[model samples]
Target: MKIRVLGSGHSGGTPMIGEGWGNADPKNPKNYRTRPSIVVENDKTRILVDTSPDLRVQLLAANIEHIDAVLYTHGHADHLNGIDDLRSVNRAMNEWIPAYTDAKTWSDIVNRFNYVLEPLKNDTNVFYKPCLKRNDITVGQQFEIGDFCIGVMDQDHGFMRTLGYRINQFAYSTDVVELPEESFKTLNGIDTWMVGALWEEPHITHAHVDKVINWAERVEPNRLILTHLSHRIDYETVSKRLPEFAELAYDGMILEL
Candidate 1:
């Protein structure tokens, strides 16, 4: 199996336009972080996780031409705003992409993007529709969507809880403020853990660097890669201070596990 880090930056992404982190150097590639997303694939299937606001550029950067499924972590705009981009893939493949989301998340996406989810008449007048199918995903359940054995884990995002997933030995969880005991135990013996750490200091709604470190120590994953980074935590500084099992993830970083 292979896991590709498509984007690593938080919702606003890095080098926020005119946010004045003092003119990031054009040549410094570290400053070029996109919104968070990833691709998990094997020989038989390609599953996309969290199509962010920068999904278009991220997919092009990764040179991804086909995706069989999309597993959503939540309905946040940064993660789901790129819904329209799947049109090309659907048209070319002549198939509907399977999109799996929990009950709340699925409804939220459909409500927010009514035109995409609801059946509509196309120019052909033969019931032209978006070539994507949204399926309700259940938490704490193991289900087979295609070729992958997916284990759904629960995570808290402060206001509400969201579902994170495990495919093979790699578990991807992000924007997680609190992890319940059950989910924490499920992370045991994971080979690669891709998790979220928003910044250096404490956050009420997101995991800070210290909290992430403490959690990692407890989980003891063989390797950990931090994602969903904010502008406050520069790549250089975080890389230097991270624990041996943990490191910062950058766009286009591929981990073949």
Candidate 2:
């Protein structure tokens, strides 16, 4: 399996508009970051996790033409607001894309994008169709999405409750502030892990460096990558701080398992 780091910037994105804090050194080329999103692909499927407001630009940057499904972790705007970008692909594919999310997330998406469920009208009604079929998921359940076997982990971010997904040998947990002991128990034996490490300091709705490191101590995957980065974690600094087996993910980074 191949995992692509579609984006790694925080909520507002790195070099956030009107805020001059991304790559300060114009001469240094490694400080750029985009909104947080990841793409996982195997021979038979291509699944996207969390479509941020930057989805269009991110997809274009990756040169991807189509997607097999969308898996949502939570309902935050930065994680889900770019949902409308699916329209183009849907028009071409001519099928409702499968969407896997929790019940609350499904409700929120339907409520936020009512046009998706509102019936089509006759004559000259100006309307749009959202190409999504939301399927509610449960914690601790095992399932499959195309060729990948999936395991769900219920997590809490203080701000909201979300799920972490373990597919094949790789497990992904983003937008997580704090994970309960049980969640970590479920993720104990993954070969590779892609998780969030917001910044160096504690945050109300995201994990700080110290927190994730402590959690990492528990799961102890063979390889752990820290993503969902923020302006505070410059590449050079965070890279030096991480363990040799772990890495700091940047936009365009890809991992093969």
Candidate 3:
């Protein structure tokens, strides 16, 4: 299996429009982060996680031509705003994509982008709209997308909730501050963990660096990649401080696990 970090930055991304690269170097490509998103794929299928506001550029950068499924972590704007871009993929493939998310997230997504989930029109000539088959799942439920076994767990994201996905020994969780005791069981035995860490300081909605470090220590994953990072954390500086098992993720970083 291959897990690719399509975009590793937080909602606003690095080098914010109004506030340029705070502590990061603008010349560094790593500092040019986009919104958070990833692609998990194997020989048989390609599953996209989160659409991200920068989904089009990210996909173009990664040269991704096809996607079989989409798994949403939450309904936040940064994560779902690029949803309309999927219409081009639908048109190219000539097939409606299947998107999986928990009931609440699914409801929120459909409520906002109802056209994407709506049934396709009888006419085949019109191909400018997205037609996705929505699958509402429950947290902690196990499901299959092609040949992979997926385990879902609920995450604590302050005002809103999110879902974490685990596939085999690789787990991806972001936009999270706390992982409930019950959810720990779902993360057990994961060799690789891609989690969120905003900065060194505490954050209400996202995990702080210390909190993420503690989680990694407890989970004891062989490899840990931090995502959803903000400009407050410089790529090279943070990379130097991270433990051997953990490091910061950059856009287009591919891990063949």
Among residues 3 or more apart in sequence or in different chains, the pairs in candidate 2 whose N, CA or C atoms overlap within 3 Å are: none
lDDT of 3 by residue, 1-257 (tens): 99999999999899888877888878889888899999999999999999999988988998886899999999999899999988888877888899999889888887999999776677655667877898988888999999989999999999988999998789999999889986789999998999999888999999988789899999999999999989888888888988899988999889989
Clash pairs for candidate 3: none
Residues 69-90, candidate 1, lDDT per residue (tens digit)? 9999998887888877776666
**Candidate 2, superposed: residue stretches over 4 Å from native:** 22-29, 118-128
The better candidate by TM-score, 1 or 2, is 1
lDDT at position 167, candidate 3: 85
lDDT of 2 at 69: 88
Error of 2 at 110 (Å): 1.6
Q: Give the TM-score of candidate 1.
A: 0.93
Query: Model 1 segments beyond 4 Å from truth?
Result: 20-27, 120-129
- Supply every candidate's count of residue pairs whose N, Cα or C atoms clash at under 3 angstroms: 0, 0, 0
Candidate 2 lDDT over 84-163, as tens digits, reads: 88776676666667889888888888779766555456742332565677677888888899999988888887867988
TM-score list, all predictions: 0.93, 0.92, 0.98
On the 0 to 100 scale, the lDDT of residue 84 in model 2 is: 87
lDDT of each: 0.82, 0.82, 0.90
